[model samples]
Target: MKPESDGGSEIKNYLVDKREKSSSRWTRVNKTFTIYDIRLKISGLLEGSDYQFRVTAVNTAGNSQPSEASQYAYCREPTYTPAPPSIPRVIDSTKHSISLQWTRPMYDGGADVVGYVVEVLEEGTEQWYRATQKTLKTNLFVAAGLQSNKKYSFQAAGVNSNGTGEFSEPSVEIEPVEKLSIPDLDLPDDLKKTVCLRAGNTLRLFVNVTGRPAPVLTWRKPGIDLQSRGFIDTTDSYTQLIVEKVHRYDSGKYTIEAENPSDTPGPPGSVRVKDYTKESVVITWDVPSIDGGAPVNNYIIEKREASMKSYKTVTTECRKTLFRISGLEESVHYFFRVLPENIYGIGEPCEIPESVLICEVPSLPQDLHIVDIGKTSAILNWERPLHDGGSRLTGYAH
Candidate 1:
């Protein structure tokens, strides 16, 4: 083949030639034989045409027979349509828009990728619509102007100079919706049970609230405005209504309500004075429903003359709910308050609903005597010199 590569004669240059596969005539591709390397860059070929190439080594000997014809090659354009891209994924959504993203195609069909085309299809419709008329250079796009609660899917195709590529598979179905959590009140069965407390008993109601976004809260008693004495506290987790000294007028259905982003524990129940008399009274009460996370250690019973604000402690270690208080001044009005103690300390006092008046029920009559007596009958007599209490005798049972 040229006597061991040109019989040791330095090769001047290489002649590159090409021929259409349809004919046998050959044509030169270079005006000068200057290529000295094994590789050559071919140019100026009609697209979609098939041809073959051969190389002729030229030296001082003038020429060498053209190398056996090389393999046939298609002379089409180097760049072609891109391949389909990766499946798209939904990134974000709103009532009016949906955002999607995808990776560039695995193959750009021999050309540098230029842009992408996004297409969408609505639920319950067969037609797929182009999201934008102009191609997008980014791999991400947000399809706007979507109807609320409408389900839609999207597909993407790449673009280059050659043309648009095949569309990628459709993305997962999506339904655009404005996010909001309606405020809600969780009412326990205890809240629904009718309360049967006495007039002086405290009324405490606790309610739990929940929502995706925290909700604004409101307490409603419908027709009646709450008394200044009543207290209510609201927090993110709970709502508390505390009517310290509830009266008959306070007996009614209480409702705790709230409103979401889209919309909107306290002390013991009070001391109750009952079955009171001239020298003694029975006081009973319930512990505060919420102890601020502490258990009640004991209850202190306090009493004061209705005319005074200060109170004298009756007992500091009373553990039971009911207590019998004695030595009260007969016919004098008194007010009583009770406080619960825990590890945290003494809590707020729960006072009775109203001032109580010592009862006027009379004491036992004076010494009795028998004025006359017989085997079958006896005469009863008694002196009225003893205290008459505060009220006149209504009658006597004989």
Candidate 2:
């Protein structure tokens, strides 16, 4: 709130200016004191830029002192409501109602998901209707009063304090019926995979089966009973067999006597360039959060000058997460990225936060002094510059 006194004069307007946290210069947010209210919306600021703003009130008496600068803020897009929940599957049903279940969305947008909304599209219609009268706190809901023998497609959306978000992809269409489907076993992707791992690595074997009520599971590997070695976990939808810290003895084909599901590696962590020099930099990164479905086989490195439109691969056979890229030109800005490769394929790439300047040549040599003097030549020595453009000096010029 403005001061009650206002210095006994009417306030005309306020002037706003901003300064980047790393810079000493301040830039005017508004060219003129045209803002008459206390609240103002500043635009045209670059995203991810750190900045602070100060305000000055103008009146007939003249401009009041600028208010203390606001806290440093990182500019970014405003947050919104949660993203859509996973598609709703028909878990159970009857002639008059269908019970649907779904998983939460991977992204909650920005806020906690307070609840979910289910919608249904009837057969031969374009529009959809809300299946649930209220937001459901649980992951399951029953669409009561579903017309018997009518086909319907279902979708689910998430809700948070901000509001509702986009709907999930529609679930498989199903017709309402009293009798349920037949018993069956299904494997995701119909994939019979041979998982490769190093000794001391963890291996997971999972299967999901969809059948009428229940299906029995039997896991074995030729001579040994898997239950005696690898432990098992069973949930309503799937079962997981995990073997931790495997050795050469554990290397063999394993089979799931009875069951059925799903990523690529996420982007790598921040790229380290602290050991950069005028012509080279040692880049390092943390492994991706996910390794698709298998362990990372290798990493790919690529770099591009800021002015270039495409990146050139530096190496496709980097086995480690750290490598030194040299031959970079001095004073040029560069962008480097790394991608992880697993049995599946190469995942998305993670890039340096900003362009890097290979940087200038080494700083000037310090404490130069002539020690030995001769009639024909002189010997000179000096202390090296504190910063060598981040590298050791190959030699020195007289």
Candidate 3:
């Protein structure tokens, strides 16, 4: 017990006593204790007896007045032990290390938890090895010096003044592996086949590849690099190229290449019809963009009526990049496409939409009239022709 004083007197020691509430005489409970010591323990007290305690302070000057008696207090010892910690779990892993985490024990043995311990066991082994040194104050620990491609299991326990608690259930088995490797191109044979897309339409090309270290992909066209043009995009294992409002000039041999020390290029090119007329149409195409690492020998042209699926070769050995297809039906729609050929074989053909109608001559104008007549010259006017024959009208002749 402490005593209050008006003077600034320092305390030197304390004297304590206890007695039954009904008894008038007080009995000393302990020896005089130093000022630094404020606690006292008494034993051999009758279990059913009512008792009270009082204290006095001694200073350098003198002893202070006795303090008021304290209230009745009970004394008991706790015996419950703490439960084991939750199972340790792998939070993260690398080729050489793994991070483990766990929750605290349910009970701390009626005392504050001092620390935690972690243990690891290799697959197929009965021995468990300590993975932590000097106990861990945090719930997280990193286990290092692990071999790659090897499996491991782990567990954790809580420590208190009572000693280390029971170990938690072992974690699920896990294996560590290296995740880096060289690039492997995964271009399908169907993708290597040439494809024809309509003009003024959107063109989308997708290339898929796989690699351990992740390969760098690039798209290249004849005389142009798509990466420099900022037209290429990557998503996971796929590289894509999208062209909005594609035109004849957009037609070309496009090659997708994957590289990471080693490089692989796709095969083939595409073509399209630039313009059409009733009697003749101009077709333009690109060489095999990838060329299969060989020079394109020439191009082949095929034509068929829009109603037919079979195509007939118009020019099988054409060497020019452009061709004029003539002798077509005036009012009929025709499908025109071009194929690139190398020493190996012919590649996929690029085709245009079947809606391209051939142009034809317009019918004669109606309602011919002479607006004004003169001696030397006369002015004439007439209604325009009903059909322009799929071609834009420039003018009319007398």
Give TM per candidate: 0.31, 0.33, 0.31
Model 2 residue 119 distance off true place after TM-score fit, in angstroms: 1.1
lDDT per residue (tens digit) for residues 1-398 in model 1:
33256845898788889999888899998876487776888988877788899888888878888888888888765678889899888776655777888999999988889999999999999999899999999999988998743579999999998888999999878876443456788887888789778878888888898764467777667576664658888887888888876787787777666875331014557678788678999998876765543346578899999999889999999976789999998878899888887655788788888998887556787888989999999999986736666656667677
State the lDDT of candidate 3 residue by residue for 27-47, as single tens digits: 876564353577766777776
| Model 2 C-alpha lDDT per residue in residues 3-106, reported as the tens digit of each score | 45678789888889999988999898879549877788888888989999998888899988888898999887777887777888887776567888999988
TM-score, candidate 3, is 0.31
lDDT of 2 at 234: 69
RMSD of 2: 28.6
Candidate 3 residue spans exceeding 4 A from truth: 1-81, 178-398
How far is 163's C-alpha from truth in model 3 (Å)? 2.3
Give candidate 3's error at residue 222 in angstroms: 16
The pairs that clash in candidate 2 are 208-260, 218-257
Please list all clashing residue pairs in model 1, or write none if there are none. Answer: 258-264, 259-264, 260-264, 268-288
Q: What is the model-wide C-alpha lDDT for candidate 3?
A: 0.74
| TM-score of structure candidate 1 | 0.31
